[model samples]
Target chain A: MEREIRIDPVTRVEGHGKITLHLDKKGDVRDARFHVTELRGFEEFCVGRTVWEMPALTARICGICPVSHILASARAGDAILAVRVPDAAHLLRRLMNLGQLVQSHALSFFYLSAPDLFLGWASDPAKRNVLGLAEARGDLTRKGIRLRAFGQETIERLGGKRIHPAWAVPGGVSRPLGRADRDWIASQVPEALDTIRTTLRLFKETFSTAEECTVLGDFPSLYVGLVTDDGAWEHYGGVLRVVDAKGKPLVDGLDPARYEDVIGEAAEPWSYLKFPFYRPLGYPKGMYRVGPLGRLNVCDRFGTPEADAELEEFRARGSGRSGRVFDYHYARLIEILASLEQMKTVLEDERLLTPRVRAEAGINAEVGVGVHEAPRGTLIHHYWVDPNGVVTAANLIVSTGHNNLAMNRSILEIARRTIKDGAFDEGILNRIEGGIRAFDPCLSCSVHALGRLPLEVEVVGPEGAVVQTLVRD
Target chain B: MDLVIGIGNLLRRDDGIGPRVAEALRVSPSVSACAVCELVPELVLRLRDARRVLFVDADARGTDVRLGRVRDEGSRWGHTLGPEGLLELAARAFGSAPDAWVLSVPGFDFGYGEGLSDRAEGFVPQAVERASRWLSEGQVSADGA
Candidate 1:
């Protein structure tokens, strides 16, 4: 009498994933598992390549967040070369990462998750997409489009193009920000600021109830991200920090280069993505969430005045617990506000126009690890090269992979909440998919591929015979 | 706005004909050129204000360049929102869409890496000439003249 339900090709968010829910004969939600069905052995293939090719080659890892890889890989190379990238290049790299933060987050909010927020969860599945959201609120959708474009524009101005710029090199960047470029980039910030403010107000206003957040991946787990030395918020460069569900710091100022000592990757038979856990606690038990929610929990305050204010209010929404995974969407908006304010501060500096951007060097170290925050979460790139600078080993712990344990738990939580007593419908299906989208996962960044999303739910009795089948075409 | 978009993968041999032709086109004050791997939603912004736009890509269907206007259609999408979906998105969001045409250049090779095949290269000048005309004149004819 007990059966299993398979939701294949989970929709929205990024990449390809599926969820299998197991039920007792009484139709009660008994257990669930989330799986990553795609895989690309990215680290394995780059082993013999010259270390110098890493920044450019690894930039191709994920088109959505290549800047993260470019910066991370270049930072790793900088370690191998052992030269301090000039201040101007360092600032420029931060600028590009900020640009990345804006664009990738915009894509997650407007294009991927907006439908679930705007359209009712049970809205006609066909109309629950950006186009549908556009039909209802075209002006807002246009603004969203422009906001995302502004993020890409910032990158285009700095890296020479939005995706995979050849600018960030090992020792430093290949070019400096021109005065004209700075002025142009600076001019665009005010409108972006206005759009985000308008969006924040709308998200808070339109979300009239807190009922949705309570059941939507609202569970206790550890949170991890980068934090400034004094515990201020950070994304580009900072020490690794981990805070428990109660926001108590368990690990502080850990040398990111020594991440292996604390963070361990565990494999699950059903998924290609590794489950990364805190070493001190052990596998699955060491499970923690990352990305916006993690960063928000780990940081004491965003450095900017406006964003700091927003951060305080955002945290207050929890009342007496850790952040709800649902708040990831809210956290992205605050981060955008922070990024815009930060962009203004960076552009105002005269050093942005410096001609001395890069430092020259040869391989000075054998093993190097680059650590920083991708828009999604903390991304680490480790590379080992020979004295001749050819890569001997490479490892990449993508941001989505870090949240593997959290994502599966989120799916399980949503599935248990929605699927009860063996009842199934589209509403239950969407809530589950929406849970994954809340993370704005880039399976391409994690699994390194994108596949089609088709919906077909198959129910099989414990004897492995089909009990009931559902299809969406 | 007059826009010429060379759309295809430069890494896939002859499929890269699109960008090569875009590179050859004299995009100036009257026309702007964009070379992309494929169309995505962001390109909708560029299309919203355009008075005329031409999408150029290599196609295996013909031995010669064939051009046609993209039909106004449904707005479903995938990893790369094709030209039709992007135009549809532009129309939906902005209340109007640029007059858009797709020019598919026939090619013999679409293997890995850059550069067009000799046969694919042979058609570039023609594709470039037609794309230039479309962006400037905003015309569509049965013959693609």
Candidate 2:
């Protein structure tokens, strides 16, 4: 009898998504899919708006990572203006991006995925959540909250709002960093550093050898990220870098603005998210993973003392590329450490206090493209402006879109490995959801609607009759 | 700390009511008001010490201002959260949560662009007045009378 098992609206991730396993006559799993069911036309709405309003307008794309859009859009605006942004504005922008990484990565690691990693994958669904993690690990949970707050507070200090700050503008920032706010951020750094280092230790000591490391989307695929000219780990601005499973650099220092030269976006009917691949390699064969795992793989060094040592230890365990999606959690912790270390350097720069920030200019170019590494992965924003500086068209390749192909392949691999021959349990289903959690895909980043999180799995018999249903509410 | 938290997006027409009410309430120095796009678990820290917290949000299901006790119903939390969920987290993390209520201000349009629908705008002062009274005097009974 042919059967189909469906997991609708996988929980604990950003926004709505689903997973389906197609079974054959023998009930063996034949195929699988990860579908992103939501879409918002941001590109369409921004068509006739003046280019000057884009940074503030596009920042509304996602509340969690609005700084990513703001920076990318502002850079595109900068290109349109054909003006060089002041040094202080760039420094302040880097600080905000780093802060976002810490907060966002902490949200992924501690709140979302930790419940599965720490409380046992098969634990009671009702108790296996952020609330449960708080009960079981109160001290750790509090630290995670504060650590995230440190990042949010840092952002609030700079831009005056934690969520969607209208700070980063086209030529530069709206205002320079005030001394009082700067001092407050500097004071919070020590505790933030202490919390992240302790988190790394806790993660390594507890779950380094867990079974999740093997089955949770552990596969060899190409890695992609932004890297400095010196091949250091970068977040704000840098050239494109790609490394293969063997840890060899496949592409080095390509202009990220000309991403169309090396990347192709493919669409599958099953999902709204586009599958981005290396144009040179073609289609599915060019599947490359991005985000923390990709960042860790593509960078030669973290350019920080502590994260460098941690990276060395991280590399010694597997292929230097760290292809295992399970390692994203570990990589995020390392990046948080790197971000804090880098923040310290930025805070000490004497030029950081300078008041000269924005570079006033008008539309000097028709087409402009901006690229930056968001917390998720490389984010690109391109804009075409008229002579009067009104936007004619825009294209946004968000960080989450870059990982769509990898996510589909991941869920497919997980379904086959766990759900077999038409026999599956809730724990097995949770394992599949846990696999999706590994990448920490943000559906909200791609499309802005967020539905309720109720994972409903249904099993249909050969005649399309419903045989069974399991729900984790 | 007494908190008046406005949870919604300003870009969505009537959804801006929460922040508008919060913005209106800011004139009173007695309460600390903030507008957040969403309710995250990190907000638990702020809720930890909040003696009274009023969560003002746009209610899509109804057409009038309704003030009610926040039922402990946001149990299955994932990416999205609510006042009930944040309170649940506050209890779990800090052993206590603020005495809280939901001020559901009904709205007509939730589409893109700023400003409230005319009808929703009319309800703003009424919602603000009620929320301020509740936060300051604890006027609502335990049963939300």
lDDT of 2 by residue, A1-473 (tens): 67768898898888788988898888777887888887766887888998889988998888778999999999998888889899999999999999999899988888988899889888998888889999999888899999999999989899988878999988999999999988999999999999998989998888667364777777788888899999999988888998888768989998888889878877665566777898889998998888888999999999989999999989986647676777888888999999999999999997888999899998899988989988888888999999998999888888888887777777777778876668889888888888788787877777521222244566889978879987755
List residue ranges in candidate 1 displaced over 4 A: A448-473, B136-138
CAPRI quality of model 1: medium
> Please, what are the lDDT tens digits per residue for candidate 1 over residues B1-145?
6888988888899888888888889978878988998777788888876788888888977878888888777766654578777877887898888887888899788779888888888888888787767765645584544
Query: Cα deviation of A350 in candidate 1 (Å)?
Result: 1.1
Question: Against the hidden true structure, what lDDT does model 2 obtain?
Answer: 0.85
Quote the positional error of residue A381 for candidate 2 in Å: 1.5
Clashing pairs in 2: none
- Which RMSD does model 1 reach against the true structure? 4.4
Local distance difference test, per candidate?
0.85, 0.85
Error of 2 at B47 (Å): 1.5
> Residue B74 lDDT in model 2?
53
